[model samples]
Target: MTYLYPQIIFSKLFGACLLASLMLLAPLTAQAEYGDVVLNNRAEQSGMRPVIFPHWFHRIRFKCKVCHTEVGFEMRAGANDILMADIIDGKLCGKCHNNKIAWGPQNCHLCHSGLPGLKTGIRGGDSTGGPGKW
Candidate 1:
């Protein structure tokens, strides 16, 4: 019974440590700091979460012109009508996500990871798909 005190202290310390860790990491887990652009034009209708586009992530890898100029994505948030078929046909995202440059659309959850509440909220786009109304 003498060792009981030490066990209690250990348990309290462990719990406190875990709580602190969660407090620090909760926001991070909620969403990455990519300044997401939630495109839910047809996602909700199709029974899926909006496409949280990691704008900052790609901006670091490629130049703006690569997508805006070459890919034809407008500067506006909900500008282009990005569809899954267009991607599969090697047009928009399919150009890179074709398994050669990046992983293909086999994994849906990667992009369809529910609307990330960043500074940019769930501002949806057009019916074809962009960033307009949800």
Candidate 2:
């Protein structure tokens, strides 16, 4: 019985250590690379608004094909050639922002506010700014 007690305690300690090691490794392994899209100078000078599209944020709402295929958006930024008129004509963002699905383009400021929020340094977690401890 005395010998069995030591074995039991050793097994329990080993299991606890294993569990703790797994917990510590899980976060490091689970970290995902959220790619970024740059709003180019062309987009900035478009006179409409500078739109910085975050792949991470949109990934939560819709699939990649929704914009990439259905909307004919190129993988490269500023390649889509998105224009306000096209949106008004039910193209690009207007495809989803029909008011039935998402917010329509009737409210111009929703997207064209030109105020930097998530993409700019004004809001935190923006990679454009210096990388800090997330």
- The local distance difference test score of model 1 is 0.69
Q: Encode model 1's per-residue lDDT on 1-134: one tens digit a residue.
A: 45568789999999989877755654444434535677776666677777888777898899989988888777776666778898889998888888888788877888888753333243322222212222
Q: Put down candidate 2 lDDT per residue, 1-134, tens digits, no spaces.
A: 35568789999999989877865655454322345444434445655555545577778999999988998877765456666788889998889888978889887655654443223212223233222322
Name the TM-score of candidate 1. Answer: 0.60
lDDT of each: 0.69, 0.62
Question: Worst lDDT window (10 residues) for model 2?
Answer: 117-126
What's the lDDT for residue 21 in model 2?
A: 81
lDDT of 2: 0.62
> By TM-score, who's the top model here?
1
Question: Which residue pairs show backbone clashes in model 2?
Answer: none
RMSD of each: 14.3, 13.3
Off by over 4 Å in 2: 1-47, 113-134
